[model samples]
Each structure stands twice: as C-alpha cells, then as structure tokens.
Target: MAADTAEENGDAASCSTATLSKDLADLPQDVFLLIITYLSARDSVACRSISRAWHAAFTSEDASLLLLRWHFSRSRETRALVSGWDSRSPGTGRESIAAVFAKVARRYHHLRQAKPRLIEKIDVVQEATHRDLHRGVAPWDRILRWNDNKAIFQYSDPTWCMDDGLLIYPGLDGGQYVAYDLETQRRFHVPFDNADKTVRRVRLACGVLVIEWCERAPYHQLNEREVVHRTFATAYDVQRAQSRSSSSRSAKLAIVRSPSDDSSAWTIVFRSEWKIHFLGLPLNATDRFFSTHNGTHYALYIWQPHRSPWGDDDPIEQLAVWNISFPSAYRPSLDPAGTKRPDADLGPSVIQRLTWRELEIIGLRQRHTPAIRELAMDENNLYVHEEEHRWLAGTQSSIFPPRHHTVRCTGFPLVGIGPIWYDECCADGDVHMSFCPRSGSTAGLSFADADAEAEAEAAGNRAPTPLPLTSYRKSTWPGYAPCWRHEEFPYLTVSDMKDALAGVRVVARQCFMVEALSVFVMPRISIEADEDADADTENPEARFADEMWTELMGKGRIYGDERWVVGEDAEGRITIVRF
Candidate 1:
C-alpha cells in the first residue's frame, strides 16, 4: 500500500515538472488557443494527439476553433479547385476538376450533417461555385478594379484586348502601351517617343506585342506630309522572382528588354514595311496574324470578302504559313506540336524575324457558301463561322435552311489531330482541312423501286427530299450536361486559342444568350495494366489518347479563365469581371 502511494506521488511530481519546465504554464491559455486556431483542420486534428490542453482548446465551441479550422479547410479547397483543371501535365496533387469537386462536396456534406451553424461560411463559398452552372457570375464574387488610370484611353470607353493570358492597350495618356500578364501578374509599359503619333491598332500573339500606328509628320515639310503607317513588334522577357515561397502574393515579374534597340528597352522582333497610299486601302492589308509558338509556328491570315455575287473563280479563304524566328530571350515553351518543351531552343539571339510562305486555299470551302462571319485559328485547327440551314419539306418556308449563328472547325474529321497537330504540322509539310458530310432529301433513301414507290404514293405524288446529316460536331463536348444552353460561336479568347494548340482539350460550347461559360473537365483515360505485352502489336489507345473528349464536370469555370471584362458603372467606377 505504501509503495502504490509513493508511485502515485512521483507521477504527480513528473507531470508538474514537465508542464513548468517548458515555460508552457507561463503562457496564457488564450494565446495557445489562438496559435492553434491559425492551423489547418488537418494540423489542428493532429494537435489533439499532442497534449490534453490542445485537445480541450480545440474541442471548445466558445473558442470557435472549429470555425477557424473549417475556414482554413475551405481556403485549401479553393486552391484545389483552381489547380484541378485538365492541364494534361501531372504533379498537381489532384487529377481532374470532377475529382476535386467530389472530394470537397463529400467533405462539406459531412460537415453540414455534424455542425449546422459552423458550416454557414462554407455554404456561402459553395454558393459562389454552384450558384449558376449555366450562368457564370463574375469571377470570384468581387469585381477586379484597374487602379492604373494612366492605361485608360477615354474615361467613357476603354480600348484594350485580352488574349492568351495577356491584356494589352494604349495607356490613358496616349503614346504609352501597357501589357499585363494574367498568369504571372506582371505589368509592362512601352512609351512612344513622339506623342503626336496616333495609335491605329494593337495585337498580342504568342507573347509578342505588335503595335501599328500612323506617324504624324510636320505639315510644313512637303516630302514628309503623308502619315506613314508602321508596325513595331516587340518581345518581352518576364523573369519570375525566385522566392515563390511567399504564400499571399504571386511571383512578381521583372520585364527585361533585350540589348539591341535604340528607341526603347524592348527587343524589336519585326517592323512593318513602310507604305504610302493616298486612299485608305493599301496593298499590304494584313489585318491579323496567328501564332502559337513563341519562335516557331506562325500563320498570316488575309481577309478577302466576296467581290462579285455570282462569281466563284477566286477562293474566298486564303491561309499562308510564316516562319517566326525568336531570339534566345523569348523562347516560348509551347512547341508547334502542342507539347510544352520548355527547354527547346530559345533561338540564337533576342532579335526575331518573320518570313512568309504563300499557299492557296483548296479542298476546304464548298461553292456558293455564305460569306465567312468570323475567323479563329490555332496551331492545330481553324474555326470558321458559317450560316446554319434547317430545311423541312413538309412545312411551308421550312424548305430553306436557317441562316444564322453556325460555325465549324476545320480539323474535326481527323481523330487525334485537334490536340496534337502542332507537333504534326511541324513534322510534315502538309496542311489538311476537315470535310463536312452531306445530308438532306436524297440522303439514306435508296431510289430502288419498292420503298421508293411506297414513299411516293404516301406523299401524294410529291416525294419529300431527305434531310442531310449536317449537324454541328457534338463530340467536341462529350459529357456536357443537356440542361446547359449551347452557343454556336462563343468568343474564343487568346488564352483559349493558345491552350487548344498546346493540347489542353476542351469541348467549348458557349451557351447562347445567357453567355454560359461551361468548362469541361476531361479525365485522363486509364490504360489497363494487365494487357498482353506483344512488342509487335500496336497500341490502339495511344491513337485516341490525345483526342479531345470532354467529361462532364459540374457547372463551373475552369481555372485559367482569368481574363477581365472591363466596363464603367453608374458611379464612374470601372467594373471589371476577372473570370
């Protein structure tokens, strides 16, 4: 009995000494609680295994540790949501958006069932993501304010363009142009020496900025009286900071100009040929240039609308290839074949040049087709807008097809070419176009006697023409929800074009009037491990692996859709939607 009592006394002494020895007893209980409150739910749960005090503090409802833990969990969840997109490249903790949403949904489901009041905050965040699967609210619940007023042109109207994660426009104080990177959050400004020059046009492609302007010559000088139009294209080197360790702020980009230019720090990649014309129309009317590679792949598009209504002699669409040479400083990671080879040749120097290869448009367009409404191009495919015609013979006025809001892509018939054509185009010297299958009255109906006689008799002397199977390619979005509205032509952003060329497959169907932004999460199809390994046999799955197949992800915007929609509200505050 005496031994047992002694042992009990010794145990009590050890507990006292251990608690006081670490100076833990000197700290206030509230301070300890506050420290643990900042930890994530996973870490807080782990603390419960540490000591009795930590367990007690975490369990207390009045301390609100449960609420803090939940907040931290949701913050982690939001990051997961952003990173859950189908980037194809691995090493992101999660795979697809659907997986991340499912995991988060299950977590909140359990939390709501356990503690109703504690989950109110999580519910608000959930509502933002889940509110409208069809109608996307502004990116995040808040508006992105552009604090730099110097970049604005007219207080009422702003002229800016966002493409491939870049925002470019002339600064509010004319002659100054600003290019902001969406991914890196880097800002770059280029100032024109002469403020008198009028900025005519601005375009951003493959990380290169091209500005075209009319130089205002002094009226006193007779020889230089005409406004000379010129184009200046520059490539910027955005060096990301090494300390990506900071949690709150993204990496700051430092724009470094090449050593070669006298007018500005930026490296001059290309200069437009000087042209003097009395009339507005010039021979070199190159309106737009499409490039997916930083230094490799390029295509120049020359717009030619119909001149004569009845003639079909001249081809309406003409596409040509261009070889863009980039200096070593402007090495783009996305190769012509869509595979991202970051270590690919940056080029020999910071100076770049573009050489054009002329080609005739053939085997693409049919005769008597309507005029092209809009044109979109990437490294892999070209999206051309055409009118939709729906002809129903039985109904009056239905014999003619519908003539509005129809668009088709050029690389559809080819199976896996849409995603990986960049690499293939660079490999071979051939460019291919997709063909649309014919459908209508005579389609699928054989005129061989028996059925033809019955159909003609049933139709009362006039046989109905069979409808053609000319439906828009629905396979682009395989698993999209039927409820979501569909748009014939959703405005394709520069980022969208870059991503498509880089092999990030998406079934992009813009919802009609509602402007529904539906981002499909395509899961990487898994291959069976137990398949027979015959070295001679070809892998069937490999052929279709890169094909664009969209899996139905719950209605939400995919991560990289961070382009801003800028506008002015009633209070004169610039309203921006950062989606």
Candidate 2:
C-alpha cells in the first residue's frame, strides 16, 4: 500500500510540473489580450520576440488597436485618424491596422527618444535682398527689427510660427511672407500691399494664420509731433489658401509658376485694430506681447510695466488680456474699393490689469515681495514665475555673490473679463516654492538642488546648503490648473528654454552655452509610475527624460510639433528634424 501511494504521488508531481511549464502562447486569446493590457506599449512590442505564437497574438488587429487606445489616446488627431481604419479590409494594397499602429508607435518612440530619421535644412534667405544678404541680415534679424530691435522676451511674439506642417516666416522685403509646406515641399507667398506696415508677430494655428503688424498712423492731435503707432491683427484662412494654390498650380502646369500664382491664395477673413498704449503710456519695446488660439477662440496677452501710484521706483506690472473671434461669422468685404467701415475695436473694451500688489492680495502671501522673472501663456492660463531674494546672515551688506532666493509659480485663469476666483480652502494651493543658493543667476536652477535643499531644511538641520557652480502647484477654478507639471525637470527658465505643448507631450528645447541646444520631449504624466514617488527610483519619467534628451548643434528659436523639431543651425538656416 505504501509503494502504491508513492507511485501516485510521483505521477501527480509530474502532472503539476507539466501544468506549470505550459507555454504562455497556449493561453486563450481573451486572456492573452488581458495580460497585454497590463504591459506598457514598449513591453507589449518587445513581447513579440518571445515566440511565434506570441508574435502572432501581439501583431493581431485587436491588440494593435488596444495598445493605441491605451498608450496614445491623448492625441485627438491620432484617435480620429485611427477610428476609420479597418484592419480586416485595409483595401487592395494598403497596410493593415497593425502595421499602421506599429509605424505610428515607432514614430512616437523616436520622438520620445529625440532620435530623428531625417534632418532637412532650408535657406529662408531666398527672398532676402542682395544688400541685406551681403550684410549678413537673415530673416530672424528682420523679425527683431520689426519688433523695434527689442530682445525677444519669452512672452514676446515669436520670431516665426510653425503648425500643421506649415512654416511661416518673414520675407526679405517685409512686405511679403512665405508659407512653406513641409509635406508638399511647396512655397506659398502671402503678400500685403501696405508699405508702411511691418509684420511684428505671426501665429499659425487651427488652419488660420494671424499676423500682428504695426503701422504708422497720424497723431490724433495735429499739434503732436510724435508719430502714432497703431497695431492691427489680421486673420487669413490657411487651408483655403493652400487649396487655392494647389488648384491654381495644377491648372497652370504649362505656365511657369510665379509668386503671383499664389498671391491670391490668402484670403483676409477677419481684421481688427488694437490699441497701442495703456494709461497714457505708449507700449514700448520693454512691453511683452503674445497671442494663442484654440481653433475657435483667439487670445492675446500683453505685459506692460507701469509706475506705481505711490511714486515708488519699482514699476508695477500690468497684464492685459484680449479675446477675439478667430473667424468672424459675418464676413464683410474690406477690399480697398469695397465698403470700408471704421476699424472695429472688437474687444479690449475692458482691460483687466493685475498688479503685483493685487497678486499678493489674491494669493501669494510672502514675507518679502517677489519680482516676476518669466511669463508664459497657453490657450487656457498664464504662467508667472516670481523670485524673492534674501541676504545671508553675515552678508547682508554685501552687494554680490551671496544671497538666498526663493522661487514660486502662480497661474491666473484666462477668462474673458471678470473677477478672478480661487479656492478658499487652498487659496495658494497651486503655489510651489523652492530655495536656490545662488542669487541673480538667470541660467536656471535644477530641481535636484531644490529637492536636496528641501530635505536638508526638513531634517531640522540649519547648516548652510552647499552651492555648486551649476545653478543652472495645483489650483481649482474650473479649467484653471497649472499650465505644466513635469517630474524630471520643473521650473524651466524662459530665457534658455523654449517649450510648446504638443498634444500629450511638452517639447522643451534648452540652450546650453557649450552644447548649443538640447531637446527634451516629456510626457505630461507617466503611465507606469506614481507621481508622488521618489524620482531617484526606477521611475519611467526620469528614465525617459534622461534617455530621450538629445543635444543638437544650433542656436536659434526652437519650435516643434508631435513629430518634428524645427530650429536654426549655427549657420542661421532653418533646420527641420523629422522623426
């Protein structure tokens, strides 16, 4: 009987081993898919190498769609494009849904890694006059000249704007602009007849091109000798222009194409004039201006420095908001000969000015008054960086080299014109403060140092934090959260880093003195990692930022989209990297 029990135990043990060693490929399709849903996009793709069965399952249509929805569903454009894709019937020679998903995933992977498959350089000096070209005056120089030779502040109008594969920049003559399509390799000329007007800023978004230009107008008072500067904004239909140009080019194939062929392409859909001054002070070069649009609504932000009523030397900053209709429902013909009405002051009829005192009263209750260091705006809110300086105990009288600084961020909602509201429980809930060792260092402070300082101070250790040579928030008011929050690198100084919100990723281009420029593509949030967890651990956000950051040899304004990064090389030529 004992021998029989032993034999039965041995047989049962062999059966259990067999069950444990069963191939993962033997799992049911539903079970396999469920497991895949738990894996990241990268891991799911890597699993194809496990076995032929795993490969087949991963490459299946259902798996591809599932991964896409799970990983890349943040991009509405991607969702819309992939919605109609039918893998079972991809048509005669078209690729399957799985193939398309692979291609897209690989593209985004390359983008996240900052690895581009192709880089193209285009010379925008073609239209520049011979004299200007000989004098080394490039298109970028002309843009600065248009802005009254003022240094382009972070909040100032960009030198150029790129969107939807279209790159728009000023031509040599200042009377015309060039819209180059990256996909079609075609150039469409957008020309204006006003010789006295110069394009100050150009913004392209949502299939519409908005140009802000300044023209010399006669002073309202005849006795006043000062020239009146009037700013006007005009919106053109970019899609309509491209379509018209394509049709015209195809019809005139036999005839040599010239700038005239595309001159009529751009149609002025909307036009309005904006006030150039506030509170009797003319808007000067020091003032900041930037415009943004979200297809339907177009908004403009202007930061002007005003003298305090109390006669203090420190100027009180004023931020003015303007919300204008992008494409007016009523289209009135304003052609030279057509009926022309007085330039309508559509908005800005009420300018909401927020001062530093008002900001302090609203939320930021600090011991020392802080100065606004940098400003950035999106379609939703305006981001402000405020810095307060503190002198060391023994170095109070010293003028330089030894001071502690504290930096914080404040976000104000961009609601049209009304009283701003905030959460009573957490009025300064969005406020995040960090300490810096160096004083007046504009190069930017790294978060590593901030993290260390916070920890040292939290431990009840009053020891002075060591300074290295480098020195390199949430609110609830409807749609009024902080504009950006990245775990790896926070508090990007506007002076060195240029950032753009491209769908799910924030593409930041940082300029290093020795490295030229480095591009970092960061996701808004990590899928596999906890936000509150320490970044030193095996955090995907930290790993991705470290791995994907790429340095390029260039020094110019940086602009990018989901797939491409466009900047100027050392030679001042426009360089585009396609992933």
Candidate 3:
C-alpha cells in the first residue's frame, strides 16, 4: 500500500464529481446504481455532498466495492480482505471501485504538498531497433491504431451468409444464424435446414446453409510438395433433413418459385472435386499468396522461394509470381496442365484474374536477404521500411534482427502466379534500408497499490481495516503473444545481427524465448510411441528416436496440422521453418 495523507489543507478539486440534476432529484436506488456503473469514481465522489441519503447510499459496502474495481482494477490487499470474508454472507469488507477512488484521492491531496517530479529514463544501447518517435512512455498501441482507428474489431465469426453483405456465424449446438443490425435496431434469425443436431457442420453458400464438414485435404508427399484437392460436396438450394446418412450425401439445388411444403422443391446442382499438383516443396517456400476474382475468371500471385533448394541458411535471392486463373468449372483450360479432365467442361477457362489496376503496388523486395517486418500497399513509391540493429549496421551483417522494412512497386512485366496465389513478377530486387521497433523489455503493470495513509484519512472515513505487505502474484509472460508476433522475425539484438548469423549459420540453428500462456496446450500424446520393438532392430517407435529427441531438446512443441519445411539453399545452409 502507498502512504497517503489528506489533512485539513486538502483541495476540493481532488474529490469526485458524480452528480444528479433536477431530473434525478429523487435519486431512486436504481438510478444511483446506473450512476455508479457509468460514472467515473472522481465524478461519483462529488455526488456525496448532495444529501445525507445519497452519502449513506453511495457509502454502502456494495457501492464502494464496485467503485473500487472500476478505479484500480485489482488490489491485492483488497482481494485478500475480500477472500477472508465469510462465504455464506458478505463480510464487512468495504473495498471496491468506490474505495479505490477515495483512497487515491486522498493520496493526491497529500502529494500536493510535496513536489512530484517527472523523470525520463534514457536507454543508451549500441544497436539499432524500430523507430522510436515518441519517448518510451508513449502508448505503444498507437502503432496498430494508425489514423486513430480502432485496432481491435469485434464481430460474429465470419463465414456463413443468409442475406447479402452481413453474414451469420453458425451456432455450435444446432443454433440458428442470427442477423443483427445495430443501426436500425432490427434482428433476424435463420433456421437450420435440418433439425438433426448430428448433422451440425455447414458450409456457407451465397445466402444459404450448405450443411457439411470441411473436405479432407491430401497430405504432402514425402518430398513436401504443394497439393491442391478439390471439394467433393455437391451443392443445393435446400436440403431436407433425411434420417439416413449414406443416402443423403448428395445436396438438393432446385429453386421453388412459389412457396410449397414439398421437400423436392430443391434440386442438386453439381459435385465438386479438384485435382493434385505440387507447389513449392518444403525446399521452395511460398513467400506470399494473393488472388483476384474477375467477372468470369480469377488471377493469383505467389511470392515464392527464389534459389535452388540446397542449403539451410540461404535466403531467397529474388521475388517471383506465377500466373493462373479459375474460370467456370466447365473450362478445360483450368486444369493443372491445361489437359482435359473428366470435369473440365465445368471449370474456368481464362487465367490472370487481376488487371493492372487492382494490384497497383507489388514490387517490394530487399537485396536477396533482409528479414521483412511490415508491408502496406499504397500509390507512388512502394515503401520498403526496414529496421536493423545499430550494431549490425556497421561491422557485422545480420540475417535477422530487431528490424522493420518496407518496399515499393514500379512498372514491370509481371504475371499471375497460381490459383489463390499471386506471383506477378519473377525477379530479384535491390537492397534497401529502414528501421524497426525498439528491443526494450516492455511490461504493463496491471495491479495498483492502495494509498494507505491518505485513504485512512480521506473524507474522515476510517479504513475500518488495515492492509498487508506483499499483495499480488508475479507476471508470467514478458514478450508479445507468439501468435501476434512475426514468429520468424527477431525482437532483441543485444548482440550484433551479423554475429548471430555467423554463430547460427550452421545447420539446425534454434532460438527460444519465454512465452506467457493463458492456457498451456499439452503436446499431442498421439506421437507414435513404442510398438513391440524388434529387439534386434530397435524400439519400433525408437527407430528415429535420436533425431526427434534432438529437435525436441530445446524447441517449444507446436502442433495443429504441423509440417516442417527444411529448405537447403545453394550454400548448403538449411533453413527449417515449421507452420
């Protein structure tokens, strides 16, 4: 707890200002409840002077506690006090948002006497990091909130649709898809095509529910090639809930002009099934994927691995994009080799879905190396913002470090890469320079300390109880969320990047860090364990034990459709990436 004192010399400005007007003169309990819920604690404190009745009501244990949470969020001593209260009925603990405000106000009253000085902490490091426009104290969230826009957007899960623009998230347990218009205060719920809770999975169509589970995808070949498999489920306008499973595998697709009770009003449209073709194998990594949909065709671009897959440490020497398209399912030209397939007549015909317009910005690449951080498209010069540690800037060269960079696009002879992936160009570009975010260890202190002395004297209202030392638990996570972090990008560079590169240049270079986990997901137990070992050979599961054990020695286990890409570059340096 922080020591505070609010003697007779306290100023009125430090108190709260929650007030009620003539409209709320009567000030019903419910109305005051609303005031406590919405008004800031500073504002609420001033309301206490309104009347004796108001003072008694706001000072109640419930009201004060709520106010405490609203002010300080969490107080270890308060929590401890609350925990000791009798579980059967509320105890005499009076800590809440109201309590925190009162306590804090008292501290400000005393601090007015002593000079509270502001200090700037300078971090003098020999390495370069991301741009630090504002002092370290500036809000970091502003980076994501560019243009003063909200960084986080809340909405229903994006997938299904029953109307035009708005889509409904499917219910987990046979729930209807509800559409809500916050503007007009209108809401609508769409019923499921079938009532069977068993057949719950669905694929959203233009504006209807296409009940089905995700199609099975083919596993990568031993060589780790790109495999594209077509969907197998047939489409339909409406599907009657059939009691049987095997027979109902097909979908209905007929349209009923007028409403009727007949289930046959819907007819089956067509079955879907795609073919297999390899993309960049584990060796040739895909850099980026972009695609566009034209009226009758679609074009894609795939930024792909540029060099011969031979070593582990080699970087992409250049950038390249491929050209491909998807026309109607009736087009034979859409085949992987442009050869006629059984369903070629239903496929798309043309390639290159994007025109020169929609994809205005494309040519951002660093000189054969340079780890990329942020990329945004704009007109004029495509920016290639970069951040390299100051240490790496001079004597040593870094393969990766706490750096950020940008690139721009100019006119070039380009083409679409593949379906769903855009590789508009096939060339390497020059090197560029820019900076990234700082490597400072950031921490957010969430729990607050109560101003003990001032709190005990504030408003002359006694604390009723004393506080204890040692309040809250320690923090577990120190860095950014792994998911939010560009896992491949580096954060700290106390050492030079060039030094790191040279040090880890050999095969199997690994790095690890502490990650605060809200929930720890255990590694799958399904790893093929020991079967009866052929005593002469090895533990059936132990055939490759040493290799797997070596990888697991220090690496954090990551799963969920996990596959590792180990691409050997020309220099024989191998880069192992797992996604």
> Taking the candidates one at a time, how many backbone clashes does each contain?
23, 3, 85
TM-score per model over all chains = 0.36, 0.52, 0.25
Instruction: List the global CA lDDT of all models.
Output: 0.29, 0.44, 0.28
What ranges in model 2 sit over 4 Å off?
1-60, 67-78, 81-95, 125-157, 163-166, 171-175, 180-195, 205-208, 216-228, 237-268, 271-323, 326-557
Per-residue lDDT value at 230 in model 2: 50
RMSD in order of candidates: 21.1, 13.7, 24.3
TM-score of predicted structure 1: 0.36
**Residue 330 displacement (Å), model 2:** 12
Report the candidate with higher lDDT, 1 versus 2.
Answer: 2
Q: Write the per-residue lDDT of candidate 1 for residues 1-579, one digit (tens) a residue.
A: 999999999999999988777643235766655454344444444554567766555444423322322232222323222233222111222123223323333333232222111110001112223221111111111111123211110011123444544555444443255655543444566433325443343445554544433333322221232222332223333222221121221211111112122221222233212211111221122222222223333333333333455654643444433333444433121122325433333432212221122222322343233322233444444443322222112111123444322234332211122231111000111113111232111111112333553466367632122211222123222122111111222221111111211112122222112222222211111111112333222211111111111111122112222122222223222222232
Stretches of candidate 1 off by over 4 Å are 1-158, 163-166, 181-186, 191-201, 212-294, 305-317, 327-361, 364-406, 411-575
User: By lDDT, highest first, what's the ranking?
Assistant: 2, 1, 3
Greater TM-score among 1 and 3 belongs to 1
- State the lDDT at 503 in candidate 2: 28
- Model 1 residue 524 lDDT? 12
